[model samples]
Target: MKSSVNQFSTQFEWILNVINVGVHIVNKDGDTVFYNKMMAHIDGLDREQVLGENIFQLYPSLTDESSTLHVALEKGIETIESIQTYVNLKEKKITSINSTYPLYEDGEIIGAVEIAKDITKVMSMYDQIVDLRSQLAETHKKNKFFEGTATYHFSDLIGSSPAFQEAISLAKKAARTHSPVMIYGPTGTGKELIAQSIHNVSAQRNQPFIAQNCAAVPKELMEGLLFGTTKGAFTGAMDRLGIFEQANGGTLFLDELNSLDLGLQAKLLRVLQEGEVRRVGGSKEQKINVKIIAAMNISPDEALERGIIRSDLFFRLNVVTIQMPSLLERKMDIPEIVNHFIQKFNKSFFSDVRGISQKAMQRLLQYSWPGNIRELGHAIELAFNVMDTGEVMIEEHHLPAYLFPSGKYSVSNAQSHHPPLKDKIDLPVVLEEMEREMIINMFEKYNGNISKTAEALNIKRQGLQYKLTKYGIEKVYAAGSKEPK
Candidate 1:
């Protein structure tokens, strides 16, 4: 039995030294019996220097009334998660949250052990953020030209379909009032874009406008970030305004609103109903004049059915709800969207790629586009990367290989490669572009080996040679060059 106790004690000591938490133990006589390395560093003293020193000698500021360890020792009272601030032996100010307990041996008091987490640096960082937020808030109040952060306006929403237009009309009406607006749609359908557009067009456009993606932020930190924090709210928290206060008199856009837990949703509902907010761990409620715009990736009914969104909160935010159209539902607008992206990338890439070929454009129209508008933008951007310099059009092969699921419908499968064309799409030009990019990609793949490139194209060597020569691709990118002739 004694051997087992000795073994456990040895393991405990090893663990005390291994962990970052400060550990200090003293005998009943008030002499330091064990002081681990972490405790030494935290107290700014060497282990050799504090090993046998009396507790009072090491921390002269500590007393029977003030020190948690002293209370645990003399009074047999354990203190858990108590905040302690004191100067160390080096005269450096330290802040810690400690749990101190009295040690017992056979129902008799033997000693005291204290575990402390150093929070000095954390407190310092929190104070810095609080100061910065205070400055930002003051700036917003004094500066009229400081328009909020929303960059997209109503003009930026680019789609001509009726479903898209209906969503836009509802969103424009939301901007006229400060009522809470909720926008729901499938993922990447531009709920955030609509939210930003509303803020940009509203009366409070000159005030602060900020967004918080509930899905991106961790659940534990969301409350403090949304509702603000009071000093000493937790071990290291400092008084700071949250997203609600930061965007006072402007807009607070909460994207993926369903990602917040039910408890947070209830708190959000109260703020919407009352026009007031209370900081975390704070007793006082302050009035804030801010517009709230909430976005959800899924439908409100679906979110409510899954218990992901509270019914009361949904009712409050539903005062002006807008449902954005999925790209598939507005597929007729693909040409305009594609052309807009083409013009956008032309300026950004500093390239003059004229437009997408008919066959490639048709393929895009046929795609299901699970990612919606975001996916469409990404597809165009990808085509730009592979499109040959000086080429006037984005060809079918230049689009991402992922777009053609399992590569089954790629240019190599030429018999089934062509998208069914409308009246205006010139079949000869579309076929020529597709054939050229296919041979070019194959040449790059096989390092311009005639036999392999022809075999991969499922054609005879002579035929492949004639086609490459016919298209003038035989010399320009024969080996590894991606440059167009």
Candidate 2:
């Protein structure tokens, strides 16, 4: 029986260690008895340093009142997804969503076990996004000239295509009134720009123009962000005005509305119908006067068919619907848009690249732009990065290889660059290969500096680290190893 118990213990330890989540087990006295590899990695502590150490001694930032493990063990209470920010043994601040439960022995709690998922990067991004709304609210009070600065206007948009103009015209008319407006289009078709342009010329021109992407924000945070959180709402929540209240008398643009949870969509519909917003945990509803601008990549009908969006809410937002045409639908406007991007980048990169060559323009025109205008802009920026400092024109070679016939994601294209992938036929696999190759090339360009490469790629260093791990590129590229982790 003793041997069987020991074998069970071994299997349990192995299973716990292999899982991705951090696991920390502590006794009633708050002394850590078990610390997994992932937990050590998360806390930046060695097992030898953490094991047998009291929770208070290990984490200076956590008090008995604040520590989930302590409360769970002492009070026999379970804490579910309680976000905690504490200083680890290494003195690095870490934020995690922790679920802690008291371990029971014959109905008496003897210890606590915590399962933690690191969300430091996610919290940082959430804070940045949420703080922007707070700052915008504060700025609205200070700056009487206008609300948060939204630069795009009807005239600034680069498109002469009839389909594009029709969308813009509808947006301009929407701006003239206070009715809710919805813009539907494919990704990278400048839906946000259109929303901003409408807000720029609207009655709420000087009011708050807050745009939140439904897909970008985490679901756990969506409710509190959209509807302000009261002080006692959650563990660390504070009294704050939601984006709706912040954009009072102005416009609040919710992009990718289909990505919003249906339940939240119902709440938003209530806000629109009642002309007020209720804080997530508050009792009173605060009256607000704000115009709503919503956008989605898919058509509303499709969203309804999929039940991703509430039908009642759609009617409230459908008063002014503008269908933004894809860039492919407006091929006649590509040359002008390409030139605009070239000029924009010349100033941004401080390079004197004059314009796109005829062959280069033809290369861009040849490919069906699956990613649309944003892809074109990215291609131009990449060209600026790859070209020499004094190069004058964006030549054919300066454009992305994917735009060329030889580098297309077809079987031939895959075989040319990746011989082993000659037999692979998956489009996603080919695209991933292209993405990895781009990262590798960017790393080479920047001498494997994580920061430089990530900056050039317009991604966070953590995101770059994730990609590196995904591709096992860091094993091959050692220069990035010297970077501060």
TM-score of each: 0.64, 0.76
Candidate 1 per-residue C-alpha lDDT over 1-485 given as tens digits, one digit per residue, 9 for 90 to 100: 99999999999889989888899999997788999988887888899988878888887767677788888888999998776777767778787878999999998889999998876775565456546766877887888777677899989989889999999999999899988899998777888889889998899888877788886544545787789888767544568898888888889899888889788899988998898999998999989898989998778888998899999888888899899988889999999999999999888878798888888888898877756777678667766665555667887776755456564455562334533332333345445556765776787678778788889999988678667644544333455644322
Off by over 4 Å in 1: 1-135, 408-485
Best TM-score goes to which candidate?
2
Backbone clash count, each prediction separately: 0, 0
lDDT of candidate 2 at residue 437, scale 0 to 100: 65
Q: Which runs of model 2 end up more than 4 angstroms from their true locations?
A: 1-11, 27-31, 53-67, 70-78, 86-93, 102-111, 128-132, 349-354, 387-391, 408-485
Q: Please state the error at residue 261 of candidate 1 in Å.
A: 2.8
Total backbone clashes of model 2? 0
Q: lDDT of all predictions, in order shown?
A: 0.79, 0.81
C-alpha positional error of residue 355 in candidate 1 after TM-score superposition, expressed in Å = 0.4
Taking the tens digit of each residue's C-alpha lDDT, what string does model 2 give over 379-419?
Answer: 77766765655568776655557576544344432333322
- Model 1: lDDT to the true structure: 0.79
